[model samples]
Target: MNKRLLSLLICLCLFISVFAGCSDEDTKKETEETTNEITSETSGKTEPVVERGTLKSFGIVPDDYVSFSAKMFDILGLDTKEDIYVYNVPQEAKVIYIEAYSFDGSGWKNVWDSGAGITAPSHMSGEIAIEIKKDYSLKISGDYFSSTTKPLTLSENIENVTVLKLDDFWEFELDKEVPVYMILADEEKNEFSYNLEDYPSTENLDGVDIAQVLTIEFSSEPL
Candidate 1:
């Protein structure tokens, strides 16, 4: 009887030891997994920085509007009413100029120039509203001013056309009823003009490739 009791106690001790060993191993594995997760969450993943003088380009489709703050327009010497300019610029352009152009059936003519010498900020870059008039393309020249404005064609075409949000004009209240000209252009570079007072109603510009747009001559009197 004594021998059997001793044998039973030994078997119980062995089972308890094996169970404890398995529990310890599981705990250790769980701890290791948690540690790995924490390490991954707090480890090295950073964004690369862009150097100055790097050239970049952006595209704007009709009906889509971009936004920029008033301070930036101030640097460009523009008195934007909505306190926002409808265009995108380089985060840090060495030189920047916004111009309005009219594409005659033959060539593009400069209508308004938003004098250059404006540099953009890296962190808080503003937005641009893409609005195009009938035959106008807003030309933003700077950064690679000479090259970018050069048309995308290898045929030595030079036309960096951009559009603006029309709401920018509708919301723009002048000191008086000013004579404004809305310039619009199309894909073939054909240009046209419209009077701001008789502004055309905004239409669903779905299949319209209206290039750049600009509003020139906000005059208290007639232009």
Candidate 2:
């Protein structure tokens, strides 16, 4: 009887050891799976991937460099003495988007956008520019007009238009004091004019009723 009881106890002990080992392995596997799930969830919340494109494709050139903060200007080796002017802007304009680019030795690289973080080399090849877009709503004489204006294209000689966002409005800080023309179009009349002064004072049927030219002036303050 004693031998039989000892044999039974030894078998029970072996069974319990096998079951405990299986439980430990299952617990460890569950913990690893939980950790992996958390890691995947965290990775899903990472920053968005920035888009890459060429400067020419986006119609950006070195002369399009506008004034950033004073620190950014210093970093890009820009001449701060030139007057910056954004011409032909509407009476009320708000910047809706901004795109930044940097030039390395070989080519111009899109470095940043308005909401994304900037990515660039430690040193650039002295070329940088920012493209700004503003809201198209025009308010005139306590009335609002819904008009579509064509995209602005800067001339090769026209430069030094630094746009900054200040209190929900776009502010132009001029460096070279150049005249920048904002070409506006009247879709209803199917006419576009850059120089309103060129037209005669005589009243005509096809006169521009919606477009007006505005020149913004700013003090020589460091951005």
Candidate 3:
């Protein structure tokens, strides 16, 4: 009877040991699976989302009746010109600076620097700057004539006029016959518009004498 009882106890001990080992393996597997899941989720949350294929346009007029010339250059110093100049920037370009220069009858003088926020000189060359990562367009008008004494006629008999206010210290002359082409920002629409009727507030600009509309387009991605 003693030997039989001892044999039974030994068998029970063996069964318990096997069962404990299996439980330990299952627990370890579960813990490893949970750790992997957490790691994947954290990686997904930390990754940044990049914006691509976006278009932005701007309309700009100089403060005075000075001739305005605008050229876009990339890191490699390549430049182009047109009514609406288009440029493709390299990947190396991280920041773009817009600057304006005035001609003192001899040489070009730096008038406005966008990076420094310098107030434009009384005689601005109608140069402006903007910082952006995606593609952009600069619509220019009244840049052909440079005579400070004379104001160029941008448009005549423009109907449905709506004036937009600008923060920059620019002046305009209101004429019923001649219409000014202004670069007005419409935040609600999320795009640039040529029509002045879209904006009614003319508190910033009083009168303007500008030229025909010109546009310059810039792209960060390859064409």
Candidate 4:
């Protein structure tokens, strides 16, 4: 073969190799971006979606009320507020309380409690003003007098008690003497009275699917 022809062929091959290398790099970059997108969606880190500019109004709902978890503010890239108001609480509920806490080096430190100012009866509207500093955690709680009940105490007879399941035909055993009056509420928030002293252990819930038990209280006091 001619030397010139041979040299020309070698240069062409080198050019093709370079072109193939560039294409592979581009393909690899595209694949990486696609993978990242999938990962973000699956991992619950997708871009936040809001209804119009509603959330942009700082969740200050008008006739209707909206509540924001602390993380919601962070996701929106807004400056943390020193105070926030909760609106549109259920009318049936008697008390609305907001708690603010700051995370210390070790644990959460209670910073503010709305209960100090907002009391029952007059504050039944469920609207509350919570004072919080930047980087503080906030929690809102409301209680309806009718729905308020006590948490049943663990009977000593049942040494090993575990909340096997919630609101289901869960399995639990009773055997011990309870000093405090026990209260149990069903799924519909209907109260059921149980006292080991009055009721016999043989009170057969045999066929009953222990499910639908919303809460059980040992003492009559609300928890």
Candidate 5:
């Protein structure tokens, strides 16, 4: 009986030893997995950073801004209200050139713009432009307007056109009635215009396209 008891004790000790070894292995694996997870988290935090931008415009609007938009039609002998101007804000990484041409009302002509230098904290570097031109007049003498004064003229091609974000235009106020012409050109020089009309409106502009609003004329004539 004494020898049998001693044999049982030996068996129990061996079983405990095997279980303890397995537990140790499991603990080690858990620790390794935890360390790997921490390393991955740290790497994610240090990823590369890139800059972002919002809607933007050229300001201070040149002192002659209004006059410039109107002159586009005068040169063509067209006494019409089709005047356009274009400008852009380029991303530091992608800007090649910027230009502007306008007729504010008095006459028609072209103006070379090296471009305006304005900055907005919320705006990233990108290109956007504007155009205004005169529409068809009743008399033939007034019918043929300047290239830019033609209703719906694009200073830049569609792919080259610049777009604006709502946040970007909030930085400036509409001091006067302004016609914001966002135009696009096709292969035959055909162009389309979207209005970002500013001043005297009581509609929701939240998330609205400023370019689209400017091109549409609201009729007060009443339907």
Candidate 6:
């Protein structure tokens, strides 16, 4: 009695299903296109906030000159080229080395560390110095002197040790040659005494801020 009507109704239902599926497909395509656009724009336009390996900001030395050097771990001296430069090394450096240098055709030197694992007969130097800059996540090892690093902060003075708390270490290194000049010069005529190879005039310059410099190099094994 209603075969034709029923067949027409079935066709209408199929049409509705197909149209709904097509609508869903169109919606999915639009969503995918929008996601791709956002991804492309973000990849092409965004930039990083900071440089890759930059650690932190350093302050100005007394003069315009910048010097790197080693130090005795026990003493912390502000005497540039006179006192040793020091870096509170982290514990992560397994095989780190510390070294020193000089300017104006000077020379090279190696500093010391207390972690050399040496148990000297009660008379050896007991100063423990360090050269590496240490963050909170690093550690120090017993074999600190086996590093190929050259720039180090060296000092044997037991009074001014930098306390690096990350690895429970108090590394102390000493400068081979005491610094004699200021690396940085600001027109203030800052006067400091340093040891030079030969004896020159002891009078301080009037205008230029002179600092005897000590170059400390630091290096470590590959991670």
Assess every candidate by TM-score.
0.24, 0.23, 0.22, 0.27, 0.21, 0.22
Cα RMSD to native, each candidate?
17.7, 20.6, 20.1, 17.5, 21.1, 17.6
Q: Name the better of 1 and 5 by TM-score.
A: 1
Could you give candidate 4's per-residue lDDT for residues 172-206 as a string of tens digits?
11212111111222333233333323322324322
- Candidate number with the higher lDDT (4 or 6): 4
The count of residue-pair clashes in candidate 3 stands at 12
**Model 2 pairs whose backbones collide:** 70-223, 82-175, 82-176, 83-174, 83-175, 83-176, 83-177, 84-174, 84-175
Q: After best superposition, candidate 4 residue 32: deviation in angstroms?
A: 0.5
Regarding lDDT, does 1 or 2 come out ahead?
A: 1
Sort all candidates by TM-score, best to worst.
Answer: 4, 1, 2, 6, 3, 5
Highest-scoring model, TM-score: 4
Which sections of candidate 2 miss by over 4 Å? Answer: 45-223
TM-score of 1: 0.24
- Tens-place lDDT per residue, model 3, 1-223, is 9999999999999999999999999999999999999998886533211123111112223222122233123334554432222112223322223333322333334443222211223212234322211122232322221211122222434323232223222222211111222332221333333343322233332232221221122223222
Worst window of 10 by summed lDDT in candidate 4? 164-173
Q: How would you encode candidate 6's per-residue C-alpha lDDT over 1-223 as one tens digit per residue? A: 5999999999999999999999999999999999989997887533222123221112111111112222232245443221222233333322223223223223222232212322323212111222333221112222224232233223333122221111111132332222222132323333433334332333432332222232222223332
Candidate 3 regions with alpha-carbon error over 4 angstroms: 45-223
Candidate 2, residue 97: Cα displacement in angstroms equals 20
Better of 3 and 4 by lDDT: 4
* lDDT scores of the candidates, listed in order: 0.37, 0.33, 0.32, 0.33, 0.33, 0.31
Q: Write down the worst ten-residue block by lDDT for model 2.
A: 138-147
Residues 146-170 of candidate 1: C-alpha lDDT, one tens digit per residue? 2112222212342323333433222
